[model samples]
Target chain A: MDRIPILRMGDFLLVTIQVDMHDQLAMTLQDDLTSQIEKTGAKGVLIDISALEMVDSFIGRMIANISGMSRILDASTVVVGMQPAVAITLVELGLSLAGVQTALNVDRGMQRLRADVAGKEADDGRHQE
Target chain B: MAVTKSEVIPIRTEHDIVVARQAVRRLSVEAAFGLVDQTKMVTAASELARNTFIYGGGGTLQCESLLEGARRGLRLTFTDQGPGIADLSLAMKDGWTSGSGMGLGLSGAKRLVNEFEIESVHGQGTRVTITRWK
Candidate 1:
């Protein structure tokens, strides 16, 4: 089974989706990402979809699921680098991606992920978690 | 309503869905579809292709490059011989799913294309056709 790699970087995990993922591939990614966050206790996840030319409902729902799942596991997920055309088609497809955080580029996504994780950690530390 | 080029791809598995999208994109580009048009066509193809596979069991995607007057367009037809949809209106409603999906496949694909049409027999099969003009 071909799998998308999940890279670990300090307190964060980075994934760059570079292919037009099939339904199975996308499902595998959803499972792999949640488990990786749980095992590594990662504080954040950054997904770069710049290489993907299309993101239909299947893929879009996977992104939203990843974010929601990561939140329950005490992590933040930021998706970045969506092409303008892909974004336009996504809305027209009726998938507004509500509740999913996004950024224009990977750099910004990383920054947002870092800040979100840092803020959460500070609040937790003060509460003795 | 003249097809300048055409091809057929069998949609038997998830990977076939990816192939369908790529095929639609190639034909759309050859027909001089703009970037956004190509994206819309390809995305719509993805949605319909998956429906043809998952809900329809297995099927085929027919890609056509059309020349109607001065407009060049791409048309895709998905056909399957699975247990067809019983209630199409309810199925087309947003956020309604048979089991495991966002339930946006039919309605969403309709919105992304210039033309959409669907026909199904309760116990026979389903066919969805869509076109995007460039």
Candidate 2:
């Protein structure tokens, strides 16, 4: 059976989820990824979900959960390479993700992460003012 | 307990899930909840509404605004009159599906929202309530 792969990129972590993304597998993937992000203290995380064809409510919720939990851990999360069909379906299903960040590619997602970090640092500097 | 307006939408067929989910999301957005809460409520309602049409043959989705002092949230109640689940425990288990189902409906819904509850009898019917707070 294929397994989810984790890649370390600088202070960021990359998680490649290779599965049908159905039922419990989807939920388990979210739970495990969240725990890993918390354990590693990574600055940011990237998720590649391009392999998924159909995303039911389970997968949508899992993605939302991961993004939400990562915030508590102080790690920003970005999802990359989501299929257009999946995006369309999510909108149709009313799964709008406002708190989570998303990008069309990993590079863009990383850029966003860097920007977030930079912005946070700038905010902190201002807070000291 | 935060009390808000409740809307009851009748489900006549499988297509009604789309409408039900849309209504729930719109209400969540209008109530000033975050996108995550809206996502959870929508996904949970999708599962329950699908169950209503596929298993219950038809039902209704009741959406109510939730507020707890300064906090805000939403709740969805799905009711169906079709054949109720035979075994709730087995149905909750992963990969144990009935009628070509992927078997993630109920359990997935539960995980999406902060609060979830379900009640059903073999033939009486099924009622599922899910809530997400902002």
Candidate 3:
């Protein structure tokens, strides 16, 4: 069984999609990512899709599902490194990947995630006070 | 215009969809399609291949590289011998899926290409054809 590895960096989970994902593989990734988020209690997830040449409706939905699931598990997801062509295709496919934050690269994605976590922490502190 | 070169690939499972997408990408590039055009064609092929596998119970893809006058293009036809769609108009409507998908395959694929055609007969089979010109 081929699996996409999920790496952890500090409070964030990193997944770099390098292969052309099949349906089963994409489902597995969704499952693995959600479970990993639970086990690590990560604050954010960064998925680097720069290597993916195409993302159809199915994959687009999977990305949205991952982001939604992460949100429910007390984490944020940022999809980064989308190619211009992929973006165009996704829009044409009628999938905007709404509700999922995006960035140009991994570094910027990480920064956004950190800021998100910090904002949440601030809100939590204010509530406790 | 006649198809210059054509290849047929079977779509039985998920792996076949990936292969079909790669084939579309290769043919589009060979036909001198731009990056956005290649991506759109590959994405459209992938969507149709999934539809063939999931809804049509497997099918075959006919990929053709076209040269008409000074214009070049890539065309693909997906045919399946499964239960055909009952309502094509509904199927082509966005957010109307017969399965668990987001219901964007047919309509979205149509938006990606320059030419789109679909023919289906209930209890018989279905065929979808698309072409993107460069």
Candidate 4:
């Protein structure tokens, strides 16, 4: 599909990459997420990729890019549901995906997102005080 | 070293890369590849497909099911008639991309497969063959 659906819940934006995304589609998602985070003023982003069967170098780079973009936009990004085989292959492929945060599933991902945002807010509060 | 089944998919666009990966996934399953092996094969196919499209300037991905006695394997061959790679050794090095890529396409693909072979002529074309046994 040309577009991946981005859902909003409170201050968090959720995205599930369910299909075998082509390179263009992956780039589109990265751009779309950046805009969504800005437009919604989202504090956190949870990207569910449990359905993703493979995280090739391109996909791996996209995920890392999304994570970086979200951070620079003042939003925390968490990638969830990576298949075991995909993870293994990614390592073998030599993509460490450094600077990308990951969680086991949607539940854990959401939890981590919430915690990270909350932690950021706490630091902000301290700064303001 | 016999191909039990084979199919060639064109790698002329981004969508074609997805098609090649899907074809490899299905063929890998038919060969009874484990989930990890199937994923690895498909991932390798993706890297090669991109090379065929981006660096090689469009090509074809050949998916084959191989049978060797009691073992079954999946093989993917990517070919393109583009300007070909001028430096095979440097091109194969990690973190050295000709374009704006992350520079791990060829090297990473090699790590994900059991067998990796490459052939290229500076002015002619390039061919990359990779295989994984189940």
Best by DockQ: 3
lDDT of 1 by residue, A12-111 (tens): 9999998879888899999999999999999999999999999999999999999999999989999999999999999999999998999999989989
lDDT of 1 by residue, B1-134 (tens): 89998899999988899999888888988998899999999999999999999999999998888999998988899999999999999999999999799999999999999999999998899999999887
List where candidate 2 sits over 4 angstroms from the true fold. Answer: A1-129
Worst 10 residues of 2 chain A by lDDT: A19-28
For DockQ, candidate 1 versus 2, the one ahead is 1
What fraction of the correct interface contacts does each predicted structure contain? 1.00, 0.04, 1.00, 0.96
lDDT per residue as tens, model 4, A12-82: 99998888898889999999999999999999999999989999988899999999999999999999988
- The residue ranges of model 4 lying beyond 4 angstroms of the native Cα positions read none
* 10 residues in a row with least lDDT, candidate 1 chain B: B20-29
The DockQ assigned to candidate 4 is 0.92
Candidate number that wins on DockQ, 2 or 3? 3
Specify the highest-lDDT model's number. 3
Candidate 3 local distance difference test against the native? 0.95
TM-score preference between candidates 1 and 2, better one: 1
Which of the two, 3 or 4, has more TM-score? 3
Q: How far does residue A65 in candidate 1 sit from its true spot (Å)?
A: 0.8
